[model samples]
Target: MPPPLTTTTTTFLLLITASLLLTITTSQDSDPDSDCTNKWIHIRQLPPQFNLDLLTNCSEYPLYDNFCPYTSNHGLGQKTHNNSHSWYRTDPFMLELIFHRRILEYPCLTSDPNLAKAIYLPYYSGIDSIKYLFGPEYNFSSQHGLDLFHYLSKTDTPSIWKRNFGHDHFLVMARPAWDFSQPISNDPPLFGTSFLELPQFFNVTALTLESRAYPWQEQAIPYPTSFHPPNLAYLESWINRVRRSRRNTLMLFVGGGGISANPNIRRSIRLECENSTSLSTHETGYGKLCEFVDCSNGICEHDPIKFMKPMLQASFCLQPPGDTPTRRSTFDGFLSGCIPVFFEEMSGKRQYNWHLPEAEYGEFSVFIPKEDVVFKGVRIVDVLMSIPRVEVRRMREKVLEMMPRVMYRKHGSSLGLRSKKDAFDIAIEETLQKIKSRVEEFAAQ
Candidate 1:
């Protein structure tokens, strides 16, 4: 205070202050709460044909009623309310649009490719395929598919492609992997185009709702459900409600009869439920505390609260393969905190590794093999009743804890809303880790 400071000293002090401020800012940015906030993701801005054009004419799709309006609100579709709380009810097949919208608004998204951890190609492959698959011109699906490949092969910057042959790039599709990766043998004609078989997708990763055994590059993500809670408060409230609610039914099966190719496990379970008798004094018969909703007959409800009410009231929800091994209802059951009972191994265990805990099978769910249920004379009621009450409670708790991870929140909303990671957050984190590991392996090679 006695003497005037020199210019060099003042400059040094300012630099020190700046360094400290930067350190604080960086620490805040790197906090676990801010995990996805600072992540570096590069989205490939394609021509309008790939994404925007498809959305512009969304009504042309066969399921336009379900597709058009829902594409708005960031692919969250229409906002719905339950118990006086607001939430978005989304379409399972609208994930392509939802993911694209989210990535564009993601804080991690960077226009500069040099600072990116991984590249994303935001093509609405799912809806695009739908446009051609259900259109007047069916074979034109192949042409639509070709245009995407051609653009990637010829027009998109060669530098990115040449760098790693697309191993670091990824695409998200709402449809099953098999839809796009149809077997070359046209003995049984497939519905969608074979865009996945193109050379452009060789090393590229595909995030789809259902992944086939072939093409090791596929990653299965959860299908979008009706409930998309905006913040931790809403999610917590829902979890608490499910936790406090009384489960009057022991087990429930809410699907239609299966196709001829695949024996209908739901039908067998329904028969068991229909035959079970309530326990009075000494013995228990089948179907004591069981309920069934035959979706085939339009008896099943689609309203979020009405649908989840039954699932939440049941101890376990029977999840059989619906047309495919995976069903969006599996996630719906999970969202309602209903422990799932799987007949097929691939239905849950083999899928959702990124989002689910890597615990043992019986830890969170029950697996009665389809063979046991069909031919081995194993009764579904008997199998469920065998589990101890304590074990059932443990499984339900595990399911409740997993609710946040399975949900997809609104895109570009406050990061504060993500104190608990949602499905999108987990996907982005896991994708980055996978890309890093793969890049390291490539470098080693």
Candidate 2:
């Protein structure tokens, strides 16, 4: 150990320490907003081929009857009604564009990666993957990874990608994580590119609407709902309407997939709806005990009223597993203030850890194993109706309480009251925290 310092030396060291602490405090408190809003984002300006070019080649986009009308308003489709400007028939794939626009308007964007807590990789992975789905070739396989590697490996500037080996970067996947996962063997002619599988992206995190569970590399965000109220006032009004609305129906399911040849729980749900629903119930002022709006044509269409009506009037919404484990309808149920009854753990527990309180999930949502519903003949209506009335009300309130953060705000409209932090806001905050945790862990390794 060194000898004790003199008074002058000790005083000089104390002053230096105070200055360092002050510098750190100033930097950390730079956002002036809450600690949650302290994320300084650095958005990658990738070559146009990654985002803009893919969008410009709209001729290749064959989804939704070509030139999807829903692409208007930066991915929120046209207004659902002549009167409602806030609500839209938003296309499912519009989250990336919505997020990009939000980033452009973000308060604390940094030009230098050194000042960024997280780097947003604005590659339209969802848009790029769609082109591969209709392809007769696998050429788009590693092109993205190759170009991405070249871009991040540049020697002209300090490489942020090299700082944490991609842990500091993240991608927003509007589609499910599986859509970007390419199988090892193309012998089956896979429907996705190896964009997420490439070595360069192995450590990168993703914000996806649906995630591949087990070894999760992505975070699940809420699937966009049709209603993005113009302001907080509209949102408050809608909440009041949902709370005061008479719930005459016991349970509701609005999805088509019931008549598939493969194993399905919707078929059982359909049979129960057909056999158990009686006209007498409506006469008794209980309305339909159960309701189903068939949408087996491969879409939970963007029509808000058509979907929200039954959910609004029902105590529970049946969100059975679909082609994948997760469903967009679940988010719709949350927005409608209807308690969603999930059939798979992958559907909820493993997906929205960042958005929903995993320990308190039972307070807002219900989960019945798919095995019981599909194989053991557990009737969902019976399971749901068994929930006490007080409990049902409490669950509905919990859902509404957790609602605003799961949705994107109206595009380019700051005209109304908004949630303190909507889905876009939550995603950014969580992404920054996750990156910080990951980078620190990586450094220790």
Candidate 3:
């Protein structure tokens, strides 16, 4: 304070301050909650036959709906509104393609193979699973999968494949794990590519929608929901809206009317939904209205809003087991801040513990055993209304807190928002951790 500082000295001090500030800002932007791992991922852009070529013939893929429409816009489905940047008709089963698009802009992605902790194979195993079932490749063996396997086994391939003998490699499949697994005990041959069953692929970790059967190698990732927020601001605003939403519906059920193969369970649900709609004010106290979408004719009305709006107004959503024990509606309900009412343990936390490990599922979900609903004839409306109001508020708040991690960021775009980790970040972070552990456990000889 006694003497004025020289220009050179002042400039040097200023430079140091600026550098410190920049470092802080970068750290804040890169990792808001320290969920990002120090390791990087190298994405393998496989040949067209492995991914894009199969996508081109989307019709050959299996689904109840027309597959081509769902594959549009990098698996974001068709646009919903004029704002192409924010809105999309995102399909639940198109998770692999959405993850593929996200990896292109992953923050920790590295070009140098040595810098990566794990190698991502953007293989469209979902489409490939049913490709031979429909296309000219029908009756032929699953040669494409074998081709990918051979490509990885090649000596000229990246050293990442050779380092741990494919232990560090991972795949993100949109379908359930059983779709790629082989049938045992001389059972009727399951229509599969036998990809996960390959002895060479045993170490290759796969993140899938349903991992209940093969919990060791296959981890369950959240299903793709309709919403894909780019950053924290947009996501928070949506959460605020959900929080302030005057939920007028008591319960909501959106699925096929009664055409499910296991019709007895769904048939009972349909009857209850119909009965709930007719409940008198005395019978159903608060949040009296119950709504359901009879999607037997056309699932989800082919409109995201048609499905999302009901969830927004609902305090609880019915999540019965579909063809599989789990359904995308569970994620959709949570994302919309609607507490899910699950019928089976497998459909709830047992299968998707990775999605929200810290979540005490009972705090955020209502569990009514399948036997209670299907056999004992429990009333969904009465059970939902019986929960204390304070408890309902607590559950919805917990859901809002857990909501951000359930979404996949829109690729090649920026929203300039602030928030915790998203689905892509968590998936890659946990994946890299797994790969790092595997590499250390089985060091190369």
Q: Sorted by TM-score, highest first, which candidate order results?
A: 2, 1, 3
Candidate 1, 319-399: lDDT as tens digits: 988668987778889887788999987887787889875565577788998888878789987788888888989999988
Clashing pairs in 2: 231-416, 231-417, 232-417, 256-295, 256-296
Q: Write the per-residue lDDT of candidate 3 for residues 1-445, one digit (tens) a residue.
A: 2234334324423543454344334544564234445566666657656765555555534443456676666677777877755567877667877877666555555555565678889787877766644445444433536778777778336556776788888998888876667533224344555566667787899999887554667888888877776666677678888899878888888887455456366777777777765667664554656787766655574466777788888899888887788877788888788999888888867877766774688888899887887778777777888898899999999998888777776764454642367788788778888878888887843
For candidate 3, report its TM-score.
0.84
The global C-alpha lDDT for each of the candidates, from Candidate 1 onward, is: 0.71, 0.74, 0.71
Specify the highest-lDDT model's number. Answer: 2
Give the deviation of candidate 3 from the true structure as CA RMSD: 11.5
TM-scores for every predicted model: 0.84, 0.86, 0.84
Model 3 segments more than 4 A misplaced: 1-38, 59-66, 136-144, 184-188, 257-263, 287-289, 413-419
Candidate 2 — what's its lDDT? Answer: 0.74
- Cα lDDT for residue 89, model 3? 83
Off by over 4 Å in 1: 1-38, 62-66, 81-85, 140-144, 185-188, 258-263, 277-288, 297-302, 412-414
Clashing pairs in 3: none
lDDT of 2 by residue, 105-210 (tens): 5656666677777888877777777666654335556454566667776732447777777888898888887777785455555666766667667788888878
lDDT of 2 at 54: 58
